[model samples]
Target: MTTLILMVAGGLLGWSAYHKIPEAFAVAIAAAIMVLPVYLVASGEGRTQAEEDPAKEDPAQVLRRRVQAVNQAFTEAVALMDLLRRDLDAQQAAREALLAEAERQQRLLELNEEEAEKIRQILIGETKASIRAGRRRELRFFLAGILLSAALSIPIGIWVNSIS
Candidate 1:
């Protein structure tokens, strides 16, 4: 209740006192000063009255504490950023390795295709040789059969002519 009375009195005094200043600016500054504390308390943000007072401890000690807290946060943030950088680098390396492996497999596929072609050519040659060998065997059997028939016929012909 007393705080409210003081704020209103301060605002009215500022509204009347700053004649040389622009009326709008003076009113705005006065209203802002009046409402600032209430806004801070309701939001539960910013330094409280006790923390801002600097009465219980030296001002230098308060400044040092705030600085150390900021420094600690900055250090932790730097470490986190470094870890993220390392993870990104590792991911890039892994992706490159996977791409390299894919290229190697492609080369192997090309080599396999070349090997398959060579095997096909070799099989074709072998099949031709087997066919020629089979033809030669067939020719030999036919010639032997013709010679045996001729020999039997010649002897049989001599006997028939003599008997007639």
Candidate 2:
């Protein structure tokens, strides 16, 4: 309907320009005003694709198409979330396994320390007993040597004094 209006205006302006109906300046002004509408209409329509039919003849069909597009988008988003959840679950499992292994290693380390402590205690006890036995033998040997020397020296001193 707007295209028909612009065409009618263009025709009237062409006739006025040809007949010199308004004379020089008036004719030019009328011609310009007449052609302007047609030019604007043509330019606007040229920018978009030509439709086989008017766009809104069936509101229900348009609404259905929009609904389908939205549903497809939602389905794709849900699928992506499911994939992300699976990936997160796999990563969590891996992390838990690593933690369990670390805990097991820590327990093993504790057991090793306990065994080392037992060995250390046994070595300390054996060392203490050996030292005590060695000290007692040394003290007995020292006392026997002192007693033998004293006995020999006393007799020798008495005999020497008597001779003098």
Candidate 3:
């Protein structure tokens, strides 16, 4: 049962490292690290049992094996935790980078809107000035026509009265 627990812990450690490390070589190395202790404990168990009768087994030797197994389990657990931490850190960094990019894009959009508004206001002002100038020119032409007609009528009327 202890050996089974050790194997499960080691497998979990290897799986976590595989996810945290991108390279195949690194993942293999991590798996090897996790597997080595489990292999040692398992092989040691088999060897000790085959070599010695259970009734005659040394108490001290059994105690030592138990200590070693516990130690290996603790080591694998620590490694798995470290890998999880690194993965979380990487995710946080990626999230912060995306947020910064979003902020920059938002600022650019606001600047574009402000510039477009300025251009629109300038066009409106120019159009108004053009309309005012056109109205002034029409008024001048109307006044000039009125004055010319009045001056011509007076001269023609005086000449007609003198003829009668």
Candidate 4:
């Protein structure tokens, strides 16, 4: 409450001085007014929370408090480090899993390509066989036509000779 009052009075004084004085003097006066209350409060001249208690802390107590703070900070840092290590391990495992999956997918693609090549070869062989069978059927039809014409003309030629 005292600090608050001091700060408010200092602000009012600085504002009034800034309007009434020259530029350099006003700035100096304002600066002094603003700093004076803080200096008094920090210097323990006025009644403060520390002055009300008036308990002088021993050196050993201060040392123990500092040590406890240091130990707490160290424990927190160790916990953070352990957490980071676990996170890194999890990331590594996930990376390995992804790599394994990628390799499996690559092998599956290779097998599919191989199967497609085999199917293409089988289709090519069937097409060649079908073409050869068509040509053989055409040749047999031509030979049968020739044999039928020959068989009809031989009987006709013998009948003409007998009639003459």
Writing each residue's lDDT as its tens digit, candidate 1 over 3-84 gives 4534453455444544555544544554454445445444445665766677887888877766665565445444443443
For lDDT, candidate 1 versus 4, the one ahead is 1
How high is each candidate's TM-score? 0.53, 0.52, 0.60, 0.58
Arranged by lDDT with the best first, the candidates are 3, 1, 4, 2
The count of backbone overlaps in candidate 4 is: 0
Candidate 3 or 1, higher TM-score: 3
The window of 10 residues in a row where model 2 has the poorest summed lDDT is 43-52
List model 2 lDDT by residue over 1-164, tens digit each: 33353444445544654675643453345345444544544334433332224473475764565466556545544444344345446755886999999999999999999999999999999999999999999999999889989999999999999999
TM-score of 1: 0.53
Per-residue lDDT tens digits of candidate 4, residues 58-136?
A: 5576556556655654554444434434544675588699999999999999999999999999999999999999999
Top-lDDT candidate index: 3
- The superposed Cα distance between candidate 2 and the true structure at residue 124, in angstroms, equals 1.8
> How badly does each model clash, as a count of residue pairs?
0, 0, 0, 0
**Candidate 3 local lDDT, 1-164, one digit each (tens):** 44454455445545655577544455455555555656666566445553366567676876686677768765774666466447546756886999999999999999999999999999999999999999999999999999999999999999999999
The numbered model that scores best in TM-score is 3
CA deviation > 4 Å runs, candidate 1: 1-67
